[model samples]
Target: MKFGYLSISINFARQIPMLNPTTGEIALFHALLDLKNIDMNFPSTTGKKKTWADGFDPTSATLQLYSGLSANGIVKAREKLKALGFIDFKSRGRRKSTIYKLLDLGSDKSAFNSSDNSVDISSDISGDNSSDNSSDNSVTLIKTKQDKTNTNNTSEKSQATPHEQKKKFSADSVEYRLAMYLFGKIKQNNPQHKDLTESQEQKWADHIRLMIERDNRTPQQIKNMIDWSQADSFWRQNILSTAKLRKQYDTMAPKANSEWQTQQPRKRVYE
Candidate 1:
C-alpha cells in the first residue's frame, strides 16, 4: 500500500459514496474503532518491559459485510489509512484478529472528529497541498501511537492502588467468588495446590473474567460446570481451571452424559 500525504476524516463518510475512492478512506477510519479492548485481547503498540496486547481489527469478511465493500476494496482502503497514519495496524497471526490503533491525533491533528456530529470536510485537506507533510506525517503517526500506549500504561498504574492490583472485578462479584471456589477445590484435590499465592489468584482471576465477560458464560452455567466437574471423578482430575473449563465445555458435556448413561442402573427405589 502506498503511503501518501493524504489526510482523511470519518465525517467524510457522509459526503462520499462507498464505490467512491474517498469512501474507503473514511471507512478505514471506522475500522480503527473495532481494535478496542475486548475481554479476550488487548494489544498495545509499544512496550519493552511489560507485555501488552495490540488492538484487534475485525476480519476483512466482517469489514466488507459492514461497509458494503468487496474484500480487496477493504484491504486496499485499510492500507491507504495506514499510509496516512490515521490508523496503526499489527498482524497477530492467522488465528487471531489483526490489531489496530487510532493514533492520539495530536493538535497538529489530521483525524476527523465525528463526536461533534458534523460532516464538513476541512478546507486545508481539500486542496492539492495536503501532501506537503507526507513524510513527516507518517513518522509522527507511529510515534504518537507509541506515546499514547506508554501514557495509557502510566495512567493505569497511577489509578491503581496496591489493593486494586489491576483486578477490576470486585471481591464480592460472582466471577471473583467463582474463581475462589474453583481454586479452593483444586487445592483440596492436590496437596501441591494448597498455598494460594497472589500470582496464582491473579492468574485465575483473569481466566474467570475471560469466561464471564468474553465467553458470555452465565453465572449459572459456571456454577453447573463447577458442580458437575467436581462430582465426576475423571473431570475432577482434568477440569482444573476456568480456562480449562471453557476450553473443554463441549467435550465435557457429552462425556458427562455418557458417564451417567453407561453407569450401572441403580435398583429402582421409585421411578
Candidate 2:
C-alpha cells in the first residue's frame, strides 16, 4: 500500500501520456505535460471548502478530506495526478501540507503559430499552374493549401494517440489502491504529518517495488505487504521512522487501548 519511487513512477507513467500506448510501457514521456506545480499547504478560505469547480477533482477532494492534506481539498488530486505523471509535487514537511509544481503540457509550440511554412505541398498539387500568366496568384493559393494541410497534420500529431488514450490502470489497481489505503491509515494515525510530496511518494513506491523484486512476489504479495505494513509497528517504524510512530502513539494514546486492546485488564469480580 505504501508506494515507493519505482511503483509510483510506473503508475504515474501508466496514467499519463508518457508511456507507449501499444505496449503499455513507460516511454520518453515527461511528467511536466500535465502539471506545472503542486502546493499542498495552500491556505484554506474561511467559508465552505472548495469543490472540483474550484480546480480540484471531486473524488480526489473527498479523498483528501480523509488524507494528510485535509485542510486543502487539492492534496489527493495533486498526489494522484503526480502519480499519474501529470505534475511534480514538492514538500519539506514543516508546513501544514506539501507543495506541488505542475509541468506545462508538452504541446508542439510551432503548431500554434500561424506563420510557419516549412512544408511546401502546393507545388506538389499544381504541376502546370505555375506556367500560367497568373502564376504568382496560383502559387499563393497553393501555399495556403499546403499550410492548411500542414496544420491539420500538426493537430493530429498533437492529439493524444490511441495508445496514450488507453486506460491500463486505475486507482483500483491492487498496487495503487493499497497505496491509497496505507496513506489514509497514516493520515488517520498521525494527523499532524505534512502531506507526502511527489518525490516522497515515489520513494515509498520504489521501496515497495524493490521489496516486490527482492521477494519475487505477486500482486497478492504486495497487497499483503501493505496490510502488514499498516498493522505492524516494526515494519511501519522501519519504513517511516520511530519518530513518526511516536507521533502516532501520542495522537492515538487516549483511545489506543480501547480501540486495539493491546492488553486485557484482569476480570473484575464482586462477591
Candidate 3:
C-alpha cells in the first residue's frame, strides 16, 4: 500500500504495556490505525467517515506486509490482540474481506495494571443477558497472584483460562493440521499459488470441517479424495479447496465408487 501514517493517543500507548504480547502484535495494532488514518486522509467523493464504522478491512496480504509476519505469525498476533480486548474481527462472508474493530480499550484499562496482567471480565463486562453478543464470543477470567516489582513474571502468568496450560489455538492442533494438509494439496495443484496468511489457512480448515460434518465425508475419505485428486491431472487443479469439494462431493463420491468397482478383478469364467 501507499505510505500510511499512524497517530496513537498517549492513553492508547500506555495501555499497550499491559496488552501487547509481542513485537508483531504491536505492529498489527499500529497497522490498523495507519490503515484507518489512510482512509481518513484519502479524498473520497462520498463524504463518509473515511473508514467503516467498525474499522478498516485489511487483507491478509496487507497485514503480512505491514506487520512483517508470516501467515501463521499474523494469526497468532491477531489472536493476542483480541484476547487482550484491543481488537475484534467481524466476518463478512465467504470470499469476503473481514472487518476489524479497534475496541474501546479505555473501557478495560483499569482492569490491567503494572502489578497484574489479568483482566476480570466478569466484573468489567455486563450481565448474562448481554452474553450473546456474538456467535463466537465467550467470556472467561483468570486471576494470578502477582508481585508489583516483576513485570516479566506477570506477563508469563497471563493465561487465556484458569485451567488451560497452553494457548487456546495452537499450530500443532487438529485445526492447523487440517489447514496445512489442504494448503499443501492446493500448492501441489498450483505450484505458483501465492502464500496464505493464518486467516486464510483457518478458512481452509473451516471448509474441511464443513465437508466432514455437513457433507458427511469421513476423515479417511477426505484424505483419500485429497490423494486421488492430486494424482489425477484433470481434477488436481479443480479440487482446489474443501468448499469446492463440498460442492462436487455428491457427484465425485459416485464417480469414485465407480472407478473403484471398475478397478476390481472380473470373474468372467465363473459367471
State each candidate's clash count: 6, 29, 0
Q: lDDT ranking from best to worst?
A: 3, 1, 2
Cα TM-score per model? 0.33, 0.25, 0.34
What would the per-residue lDDT of candidate 1 be over residues 19-125, giving only the tens digit for each residue?
23365565455444422312112223453211112234577677676566787776677787666555667767878776654543332433332222111111111
The deviation in Å at residue 117 for candidate 3 is 26
Tens-place lDDT digits, model 2, residues 164-270:
33323243344334444456445433444466665445434443333333323333323323333545675454435212322233233334324323333332110
Per-residue lDDT, model 2, residue 12, is 46
Q: Residue 57 error for model 1, in Å?
A: 57
Candidate 3 lDDT score relative to the true structure: 0.50
Best by lDDT: 3
Instruction: List per-prediction Cα lDDT, in the order shown.
Output: 0.46, 0.33, 0.50
